[model samples]
Target: MLKNDQKVFVLLENNNPQVESLSKQLEIPLITQKQIDSHRDGFFLAWRDNKLALFDIKSPKKGMSVEFDARSMEQPSWPAPKTGTLAQAIGKKTKTVVDATAGWGQDSFHVFRMGYQIVSIERSKIMAALLGDGFERLGNQSWIQQLNLKSPKLIVGNAIEILQNLEYIPDCIYLDPMFPAKRKKSALAKKPLVVLKGIVGEDEDKKDLFACALQVAGKRVVVKSPNYAEPLGGKPDLSFAGKLVRYDVYFKT
Candidate 1:
């Protein structure tokens, strides 16, 4: 794994101590955003519009940064929570879920919006840092804080190790290990996944991750897969199908 210092640096919007504090937390070089123009070969974390974001230095001024927004009403699937594929897989009985591969955290956030306590585990510090920023933003909202909605806990480590050592077992273990898109080309290329793949690459120990989830989940383990890929957990006890994806459910016997 490439160290954050080797691949990422932090750029402050101005001279803010809070931004600097965030930079230190990421453990990468800190510089003013103005300095980004001269250094455009690697990734840089920048503060913009009151949000923490990841920017590629090469086109720092041209494109958007990775931002996670966890507000329930803002998410596309929140309106009909019970109808979503992830909600179906989780069902009403699930009390807690550990999202073992929280790529961009969409599924984990969805689970949280549906009222299930969720924990997100991402081995990629790049993703974890971005996810942390997102959760922090959500925590500050008056409505959320007033209602006492807790942000999903983020653990920056391999899920296999974290799962094996959890203080308490989760009702469901969720896995969405990265799989290449089934179709070669699509109208809307998923830029987040593209940028993520550039940072984290593919999961090489997917089978082992599934095995670990099976061992730790109290009630069941669920794996999300593209329609074209084989089930990650071999033959599942049940499966929930969606438009472009499916969830393989393996109940604990």
Candidate 2:
């Protein structure tokens, strides 16, 4: 049975003593939920430890709906230009783009709106579920009803494991991995942070992810990084500047 208490607890598995200890240290209650038995065919309903949503165990590549209300509750100021933006750094000729680290599908959705076929890849199972739910709602919007635009494709798995196996080679590849903040004071409040923190922990293997992305993009790769962060691949051949962010562009030449 689900915990009825309003105060959230840190849910854990019986085998994870370290996690349980961490939960206790944080002053959060630790609750354990029963994992449903899988059928002979290897299918079982996916569920969250404390969350109410009935999350199906499916990769984001399969598709899902995101709540419009939740997306509306938070906003991130996207960089746009008077003429062209960082998105166009790969050039207007490019069509298909893959977001290698599609944490919450924000960047992927923006690229989809820009008349490109986007393949969004999110690695974490929980993040993928949230993204899947969001995409489901996004696909059925009234505006989508009038425009008849197809939804962006979603792929859930370690990007390093999936990118090289893709059947299609995208014209542009995009990456925006989580980076350590320069100072705790500069951190911005993002709605996805709480859930993502629980699922992703920390990104310790970004170097491997970058190598995989470099192997997959056909024409170019674009990486979004903070102004103070180092370039993704040494110095990019070209770069676009924003107020607090930068887009590093590497060409296939």
Best by lDDT: 1
- Candidate 1 lDDT over residue span 74-182, tens digit each: 5444323566667778777889889999877788777777778889998887678788878787667665666667778999999989999999999999998877666
lDDT of 2 by residue, 159-227 (tens): 889988999888888988776666764556353543344346557677788777888889888988888
lDDT of each: 0.76, 0.63
Deviating ranges (above 4 Å) for candidate 2: 1-84, 185-191
Root-mean-square deviation of every model: 3.3, 11.2
Q: After superposition, how far is residue 40 of candidate 1 from its true place, in Å?
A: 6.3
- Between which residue pairs do clashes occur in model 1? none
Candidate 1: 10-residue stretch with minimal lDDT: 70-79
Q: Please give the lDDT score for candidate 2.
A: 0.63
Best TM-score goes to which candidate? 1
